[model samples]
Target: MLVQMFDLLATRRDFFVGLLLEHVQISLVSIAIAIVVGGIAGILISEFQRAAKPTLAVVNFLYTIPSISMLGFLIPFSGVGDATAVIALTIYALLPMVRATHTGITNVDPSILEAARGMGGTRMQTLLRVRLPLALPVIMSGIRNMVVMTIALAGIASFIGAGGLGVAIYRGITTNNAAMTMAGSLLIAVLALVVDFVLGFVEKRMGMRSKAAKRTNRRLAVGALVACGVAAACAVVPGMVAGAPATINVATKPMTEQYIMGNMLKDLIEQDTNLKVKVTQGVGSGTSNIEPAMESGDFDLYPEYTGTGWAMVLKKGGTYSEDEFGQLKAGYRKKGLGWVGMYGFGNTYGIAVRSDVAKRYGIKTYSDLAKVTDRLKLGAEADFFERADGYDALCKAYGMRFGSTMQLDIGLKYDALEQGSVDALIIFTTDGKLSHANATVLKDDKGFFPSYECGNVVRTKVLEQHPELRAVLKKLDGTITESDMARMNYQVEEKGEDPEDVAREYLRAKGLLK
Candidate 1:
């Protein structure tokens, strides 16, 4: 337990540094955006005496909405990524800054305004020199609030595939791994505390300078303004250029067959069409990656399971026939996404036992395994821990309980099972390692799991724009099988071959590529 805790902590330290940087980046950008946009809105709203109360009320109401729900609402439009996260945080930060700006500007002393007017200062000059100076502290305070809230909110961005400390926490919680959960939670807390302290120090320094009779140093202020302008220009350059015809954006989950398939498709599409492809991996669990990126128009294509499309992407709940490709296609169409066709394969979930263990226990089927389940240990992936058809549900259906069972990450399950630490594991039917290890897949005599055929999901608009893309993808239909997918997965994941290389080779062998 100690060693496991130490390992988790060490891994968390690495993730913490990355999370801290991401938090800083998102919070700073969001706060900056809030200041400029909210400042303008505040100024405009302040112009009308009747509008001020209503405007402030609206902003306050928006601020009261829970951040997570706000993020979910934004997903269909903004999709999953850093952009959505920043936009959501920016909106959340707007209320405090707007309120601060209005209060600061309105509270300017009438006597001071009269004195400035009598001194022959123009409206612009008086507003800039007197009103701004007096209000700077309050505006800064608003900015401080925005900064703190945004940092906290940014941690949750990982839910939508925006990597941060939240990824660690989400992974830990889903896996039921106490060591990982503690490490992630502790690291995030420390990051938040540190950032808050740093910002507080800056706020204090600014306050001290404001109290002194001296104005803020003009050169320092100008330098900061210039730096911000440069950063803004840098961010805008990417969307300007027209992406190439063969360019494809493949989005997929991290360390899974879908991820590998997405990368492979990128290569196959490029090789067959002579186009460029960019693969974006590490998307989080479920159809979370599919709809968001598709709706936002950020991704060109991605691999998804038919059942995932049926239940999650389509939001339809219940058992369905295994040969329901049409249902999956209909579901995607209804959701404004396009289905390009299957990869001629399905990756089913099943219980796997080491060859030696299966031989020892004479366990060839799930029914046989039930007899010895009380003496065996089971390991499951994070998703399998929580999914309706997962270990808990499976156990209930089987009327048996393992002697000891724990959730393990999909990536680590093979190692754990191979080392004899776990007697059985929940795994994808087509996982390459299962073939490599001579493991036995217990037949689901009861057919507990749903079918998960692999296919490409595209934005409806993208399909309209590039009609040929769907045809290109459709060529792969009925070509790859479960065993073939397993070999390909093993080639990339275990044999250290590039996914693109594996894909190209497969395509070439199939005479799909020149």
Candidate 2:
């Protein structure tokens, strides 16, 4: 484990540093936001004795809501990424700081406050000199608490594509890699400890030094003004640039069949047509990313599963046939989206076991696996834990429970399964490892998983303006099959080949490109 840690640190130094940086950035921003908002809230609560109890109760209640759910609630407004994470962390950081601020400011010696007022200090002057100075040590304690809470919450924020050390931790937990998990946890712990220690020292020194107080206040005032000015400028500038290169933006989840298809389409369209293309990888699983990006006009085109589109994007509540093209077309139309074209293959979900394990257990079908369920171990992606038709449904259907199980991210499932750490895994049928490692996918006799046909879910406007994109993509629609997709995924994911080069080579070999 030590060797693995050193190796990961050496090889992934940049990634670890980036994670640590994001960790600090999120924590600092959250603490700052909390201090501003919570301090004001504390002040308001302090002024009115009658309102104090209710206000504290509300802020305290907010602290009880799970951080991940809070993030999900903010997803619609903020969308995914750093903005959502920062906002969530700020809210989480508010409770402790608010309580501490209210306690600190209100608890200042009433006699001192009276003396300041008698000395001709105005209300603001009294606040700045007597109340604030006396409250500094306690407020610093609150700030310290906020910092720790924000650091912890930062990891959960990675679920919404907010990159941080949490990504590594989530990947480790899902993939069942103890080394990676410990690495992420250790790094976060170290960061939090270092920050807390440094801040504590600063607080102790500030308590002793009367001369440093005024200078610190001046610096803070200037910093706040500069930040406000920068924010005002950013608000005036539009998020999207006009007359920029006309490009199609594709969003997709990591290590899925749709991700591969999205990459392929980007290459095909850019090479064959006079259009620019960019792909945002790992946007989140299912239709989590599709609707928001399309509605916000952040993305132009991306691949989505037929069933996911039918249920999530369309808001239709029922299952559809595997080859229900008409239903899919109608659904997309109703949702104000366009289906550019469909891939020939359906990336179905299946339970895969190592070939040796399959033989040992006589597990040929989904039912067969149930016989030896008590002796086997199962692994699934992180999202699978909450998915409607995922682990919960699969286990219920099979009437089986395992001796040990782990929730892994989709990206790391293959590696964990291949290493024999997990006996059975929830995997996509088109996963590269099914063929690469000779894994056996048990037959689902009950047909639990619906067909996940790969296709471009393009914004209606993009399709109308660039009708040629539809035609370009349609040319290669049925050319790639399940096996072909698996191989291509392996080429990029396993063999370390660039996805764009893999797509180009596939297109060239198929005579689709000159």
Candidate 3:
């Protein structure tokens, strides 16, 4: 496993190393914010002893909220991206930071404080020269804990379009590439360990009671900050300034197929025009997150589906229809959005049953499956259960009454079905696993599912600004059929091919690229 991980590092040095820098930047930013805010609050609470318990209680309550829940709560206010991730991480760091500072400052020897007072030391002088120094070790311990936890948690920053090592981990898991997954996990683990070790050394150095040791401590702090700043700069987004080149920010839903498409979009736009493209892949919850970011101009465009636009974004009621595409277009226009490059494919929802189960039950359609649903266990990704067209809708439409329903990760549902842990699972028609799975796709006989033809959902203002993008974006229109998309997905997910390479090869085969 270690050798495999190293091999992956060798092959994909840029990807892992880039994410490492992003992780560092986010962790450091969160740490810096926590120390400033939390440390100050800690000092105040320590001085006003009456407020100490109450402030700590409030922060402790905040610390108990799950990170995912906190992020979700913050999304509406902060929008998405690095801002939200940093805020959540800083909030989580507060309890430890404040408690440690307060504990350290208040625990200073009374006699020493009295001696400082007797020597005519001012409050500021006592704190700076006497109390803080004594409290440094305890404070450093808290900082060390906060830094390590912040780094580990930063992996989740990718969920809200805040890119970090977590993106690599998510991609590897989705694509069923164990080596890639291990490589990402190992990098994050190594990073946390390295940062912890450095901070630990600094903590010990700060504890030494001598002029040389104090100078060394200052040097270590500056050195650590400089090194981290350099690492972070390496992964920061291409700088945008008053005179910078025109740039397009593209977003993608969290899926292997979208990653391939995102890279393709970047390559095409950059190749055909002067616009620089930045693709942030795997924005969690698809339309729910990305749409808002789009509205706020955090993203200029992304691949979107007709059904998602119809139901999720426009909040249109009733089953979706091809006729409603016009309405969807008009609705998007109201929101200053436009659709282009409708890729020729339908990734509609489907229910797949283990071949053995299908054969035993003679299930070929929703109606047929409904007859025996009560005897079978159903499974689907958590998002599937929440979407309007998902589990409950299907169950009501066909009167399905499963014996049990399991909420599994999108990547694990197929595995669960294959292993006989689940008799049926939901899937997108374009899922790569479907190409070689031992499952039968049951017909949506009731016409319950909606079409999900993928397309570029661009900000209309961008179109007006960069006319060249229109042609480049349209190059993908009607170019890829369902089979083409599924095969591309298969190449990436099953074969573990790089998504950009797969997308590039497909585009070349179609003579859409030089």
Candidate 4:
């Protein structure tokens, strides 16, 4: 395992390096902005005691909101990526920064201020020269806390398609690669500790009694601030900076197969064209997030399902025309999008019963499973329960009456069944777990679930901008089969193989990648 991890590091050195730098850039910028804005607000509140309660209340409330939830809320307005991430991180950093600055300033010696006034120092001079310096230690403590917290919390930024080590973490989690997840988490923790140590050193230096040491500390602090300014500038725009390669943003759902697909698109685009591809894999709500991002021009394209668009995106009814897929394409075109490269796979939904349960109950099909559901429990992800073609509808259609339904995370459903927490669970056709499941997938004899043909949904503008992409993407059409996807997913999820490697191998096998 360690050998594999080392190989992963050696092979993906540049990838990890880029993500680490991005993580640093985001954390630095968020801390810097939070300190400035939060410090100002803190001073204002300290000056006007009446505002303190409400101001702190608001900051505290924002701090309490989950970072993922905050990013989701900000997406419609700020869109996705680092901009949204920085904003959310800054908001969270505000509470510690504001409270610390306020407490430090308010706790300063009253006699000292009176002395400054006696010396004819103006109010501003007294606050800056006397109060601020005296409050430095406490404020530095706050800054340290704020900085570390922001750095740690910054990982969630990847959920909204922002770049960072969070990509590694999210990718690892999705593919069940503990080594990759640990590597990403270890780096984040180390970054936080290192930043905290630097701030602590600066704080200690400021407290030095010697004038020479004070001068040295001032120089060091100024140099650090200058470096921070440069990093912040880079973080503010990331790939949008002048001279950077033209970027195409592709998004992916939070699943193993989608992660692999996102990487495949990135590899293909970069290899075959002058453009750089930035894949934002693991967007929280899949189509819900990526569709809006695509329409708003935030995302250039993403892998999507035909049936999902049929029912959810277009809100079409159960009944459809013979050219239903044609209608699906037309619907997306109306929204300024185009479908390309049907990957020749149908990762549709399925029912998998614990092997023991299936054998004991003679459940070879959906109807057979339904007969015994009265004594068994059903399990599926939360979204599976709420989707248009989801739990309630599936149960109603098949006349299933499970003793109870357990809402599990998509990743945990297999484990839930293995642990006897559920007798049957919803499973994706391409799910890696299916390869090794101690469960039997029941045949959908009723043909209740809609077909979910997989393909790329690209923005019309992006296609026009890079006409060559149309041909490059054609290489993927009619390539991957459902079994092929399931096998690749298993490679990543159970074998701990890197998704990029697995994707590359598949594309290489098909002569699409070299």
Report the C-alpha displacement of residue 499, candidate 4, in angstroms: 2.0
Q: TM per model? A: 0.63, 0.75, 0.95, 0.93
Better candidate by lDDT, 2 or 3: 3
Q: Pick the candidate with the highest lDDT.
A: 3
lDDT of 4 by residue, 94-204 (tens): 999999999999999999999999999998998899999999888999999889888999998888888888988877777777677777887899889998898887778
Q: Residue 501's C-alpha lDDT in candidate 3?
A: 94
Overall local distance difference test of candidate 1? 0.73
206-257 in candidate 2: lDDT tens per residue? 6665667758856766886898678556644653567555778777665545
Error of 1 at 260 (Å): 2.7
Cα lDDT of model 1 by residue, 199-281, tens digit: 67666656665534234545556777898788767656664667735466777765546655665677667766655676655
| Separate clash counts for every candidate | 0, 2, 0, 0
Q: What CA RMSD would you report for each candidate?
A: 7.9, 5.1, 1.9, 2.5
In order of TM-score, best first, we have 3, 4, 2, 1
Model 3, position 271: C-alpha lDDT score:
87
Q: What is the lDDT of residue 132 in candidate 2?
A: 76
lDDT of each: 0.73, 0.75, 0.88, 0.87
The lowest-lDDT stretch of 10 consecutive residues in candidate 2 is: 170-179
- The 10-residue segment with the lowest total lDDT in model 4: 315-324
